[model samples]
Target: MDTDLTPLRDRIDAIDRQLLELLNQRARHAQDIGQHKHRAGQPVFRPEREREVIAKVLQANAGPLLSDGVTAIWREIMSACRALEARQQVAFLGPEGTYSEQAARQFFGSSCSFAACTDLDEVFRSQLSGSSAFAVVAIENSTEGAVARTLDLLLAHPVQICGEISLAIHHNLLRRHDGLDGVAAVLAHPQALAQCRQWLDKHLPGVERRAVSSNAEGARLAAHDASLAAIAGEQAASQYALQVAAPRIQDEAQNRTRFIVLGGQPTQPSGHDRTSLILAVPNRAGAVFGMLKPLAAHGVSMSRFESRPARSGAWEYFFYVDIEGHQDDARVARALDALRQSCAFFKNLGSYPIGRE
Candidate 1:
C-alpha cells in the first residue's frame, strides 16, 4: 500500500527551503555583526554569548528533539555562521583522536581545523606561535583530583582561559581481535591506565601494562600487534581499526575530564561564569585566613581549591582557586582587590562561561 505522502512531501520540501533561507539570512546578519565587532576590536568567538544562545534554544525546546539534539544542530549552524566571519584554528594534545581533540571540537564545532601536538606544552606553544587561535588542555579529571602539569602550565603561561568543556571519560578496552586470550600487555596513556586500574586488576590480571603518549597512540600500536590491547575511547577504536574488547573499563562510572580553551584574550561575563586564580599567601601567621577572608566578606563563593608546590622555596606553594563569578563582577572585583594584599604572588588565570557540554 502506497502511503499518501504528497502533502507531507510538499510540507517537508517547503520547510527545507524555508530553513535554508533562514540560515542564509542568519549568516548575513552574523557577517554584519562580525564587521561591526572588527571595527570595535572585539574577539571573534564569545563563549558567554554562545552559552546564552545555547541555553535559550534549549529552554525553548519542547518537541521530539532533546537538548543535546538541538545543540548538535545549532552548533553546526553557528559554526558555519562564525566561519562566514572567521574560522578558528584549535590546538590540542594529540596524534589525532585524543580526548583533547574531542573536547576542542565539542566547544569549537566542525568549522575549525585542528593542530595536533605531541605534548601539552606544544599545544600551548601552538597558540603562542599563531599556529592555532586557541589551545584546549585538560585541567582536571573527576577521578584524579587535578592534572598537576596543566596547573603548573597555567601559572607559567600568559594565556587566558576563554572557554571550558567537560567530557565524560569512557575508557574502552580495545583489541585487534575479539578474544583477550594471549594478550601480553595493555597500552594506554598514564592517566587512562590509572583510571582503569581496578578493572585491569580484576579482568586482565598479571598482564603487563605500559604507558604511552596518548590513548589513541596506544590504540594505534594495539592495532598493529595482535598480542596487545589498549585502553582508549571509541574514537581510538575507529581511528586505529580495533575492536571494543571491553567497554567502560574505568574504575569510576562517572568519570569526567574538564578542559580549558586558552587564548590571548579573556571572556566577558555572561551572567553565569567562573574565574580561576593562582595565588600564594604571605608567610606571616594567619596568612591563609587573610587570603580567604575577603571572599567571604564580599560574598564571593569558591568552587574549587588546590595547592601545588611553589617549586622555588620549600614550604611555599601556589593555590589554584576557582571562584563562582567573573573577575569583573563588583563583589568579585572587591574580593580580588582585598585578597591581592594577602598574597606573596597572584595571577588571574582567566574567567569563562560556566555552562558547557
Candidate 2:
C-alpha cells in the first residue's frame, strides 16, 4: 500500500514558511516601535510589558510547542529587537571564557557587546568611567562564600547594583590527552582549585596544582602541554580544544556564584528585588543588632549580612547587607532612616532585580 503523503508534507512546509514570514513581519513592527521609543526617550527594555506579552503569547499558543518554549523563543526575539535599538555594552572580570563571562552572557544575551576586564577593580572602573554601559562582577560563591575584593570595590566605587546573575560552577578537568592517568600537573585559578579541592585530592592525589590568573589561562596552559590538566568550565574545554578528563569535578553539585551588574543609575524595581548597602558601626556591643532591628520592625528580610574590616579606621568594620526590597519602597525607606540613626556611616549600594537560581 502506497501511503502518499507528499501533498500534506508540502502543505506543512508552506505553513512553516508562512510562520517565518509572519515572525519577520513582527520583528519589523518591533523595530518601528523601537524607533518611536527612542524618539520619546523611553528605555528599550520594559520588563513588565515584556512579561505581559509573553503571558499573552503563552496563553494563545496551544499547539506544537509548550508555553515555556514559546516564552523562550519570544524572549530571544525581543532581545534581538532591543539590541537593534540600543547596543548595550557589558563589562566583566575576565581574560575571556571566564565564568563571569558566562554569567554576563546569561544575563545579557550573547548578541550584546562585551568588554572583558583583567580584574574586578577594572570591571568597576569600566562602568564608573562609562567605558562600558554596565559591568558584571562576582559578589559571592557558594563554596567559598563572599568575595571580599568585590565588597571593597563596592565600598570604594560609586557604581550601583543594577541587576544580578547566578551562575552554577561546574569545574571540569581538561587536558590535551584523552585520559586522566597521563595528566601529571593541574592548572587552574586559585579559586577554582579551592572549590574543587576534595575532588582533586581524591582523584589526582599527588598531582601538582598550579594556580594561574584566570581559568582561561589555565585551559590555555593545558592545551599547550599534553600532560597538564586544567580545572575550568565546560566552555573552556571547547575553547582551548582540551578533552574533559573529569566533568563536574567541583566539591559541591549545588555550587553557584552570584554576579552583580553595576552601573551609574539605579535599576527600576522588578517586583522581585534586592537592595545592597554598606554601613560602618562604632565598636560597641549590640551595634549590629540595633541596625538590623529596623528591618525586623519594617518586615524586611535580610538575605545576606557580612562585615569587612574598615580600611581607614582601626578595630572597626564595615557591614554589607542585602535586603529583600527596593530602596524606593516605603518600608525600605523607613528601615534606612532608622539604620542611619544607629550607624556611624551608611551608603545605599542601589537596589536591583533579584537573580534567581
Candidate 3:
C-alpha cells in the first residue's frame, strides 16, 4: 500500500500562491516609490539603499535558506522593481560571454541593459558619453595581480567606483572540433593566457599563445577557426557554440578576479564601505612614511596598497590605497586631512559598499 501525499502537495501549492500575491504587492509598492523618485529627480538605482535592505532582511532571517540564496532572491526582486522605474544601461568589456559581462550582470542583475565594448577604454567612454549609466571592468586578479589598463583608465576617466564584484574565474579550453586534434595555437586575453600558463605548457607544448581583447573574443575567433583553441569560461563556450576540449585549465584551482562598478557620482556612506584613493607623495626622504602615518595615528585600517608608475620622465609613483571606512567617518576624515599635507597629488576614487566574497 502507498501513502497519500495529496494533502502536502495542496499545502505547498497554497503557500506558493500566497508568496506570489505578496511578491506582486511588493512590486506595486516599488513602482509607486519609483514614480515618487522620478518626480523628485532622484536616481532609481541606489547601491547603499539596496545594501541596507539586504542587511535588514539577513538580520531577520532564521531559516534553512542560506544567506547567499536569500541575498540573490532579494536582489532579483529589487532589480526587477528598479527596472520598472528606469532600466539601467551598463557597459562592460565584451562581445558578450566575458567574465566582465558576468560581473555586470551579477551587480546590476539581468534586468538592466548591457552595452558591450570592444575594449576597456570603450567601456569608460560609453558611460562618459551617456550611452551607459554604469560600467563594469576587471581591476585585479588574485593570480595575475592588477589590471594595468583598468587602473590607468580609472585615473584618466572622471568615473568613480560605486560598487565592486569578486568573481571566481574558471577557464576552459574551447574549440570547434570534438577533440583537441589539429589545434595549432591558444587564444585568450593576456591575463587568461598567463593564468593558465602552467596547464598550457604541460598539455599543449610549443603552441603559440595569442592575446586578444577578451576571452570571449578569443572564443568567437575559435568558433570559426578549427586550428585555434580559446581559453575562456563556460559562458563563452555556450555563447559561441564551441566544445569544451578541456575544462578548468587554469594553473590555480581557485582563481578569482575583482571588478569595479563605475558611475558618475559618489555613493552615500553605507556604514560598511571601502574608500579607494590614488596618491603621489612629495619627492623627499620619509615622504612615503609620512603619507601613511595618519592612518596609524587615527586608528584606521587599510585593506590594500599598490604602486603604479606616474609615467613621467622623473621617477614618480602613484600609490593606490583601499581603506576600510567611508570618507565621511570621523576617523577616516581626520586621517585623510592629515594625509593630504604629505601628498603631491591625491584623488579619492569614491567610497562604496564592500563586496562579499
Candidate with maximal TM-score: 1
Q: Would you estimate the TM-scores of all the predictions? A: 0.96, 0.88, 0.95
Model 1 clash count equals: 0
Q: Which residue pairs come into collision in candidate 1?
A: none
lDDT of 1 by residue, 25-81 (tens): 999999999999999999888888888888899999998998888997988888889
**Index of the highest-lDDT prediction:** 3
Query: Which regions of candidate 2 fall more than 4 Å away from where they truly are?
Result: 1-12, 45-72
Give the range where candidate 3 is weakest over 10 consecutive residues by summed lDDT: 1-10
Clashes per model (N, Cα, C within 3 A): 0, 0, 0
Candidate 1 accuracy as TM-score? 0.96
lDDT of each: 0.89, 0.83, 0.91
Candidate 3 regions with alpha-carbon error over 4 angstroms: 1-10
- What lDDT tens digits, residue by residue, belong to model 3 across residues 70-141? 988898888988898888899999999999999999888889999999999999999899999999999999
**Which of the two, 2 or 3, has more TM-score?**
3
Q: Any residue pairs clashing in model 2, and if so which?
A: none
Winner by lDDT between candidate 3 and candidate 1? 3
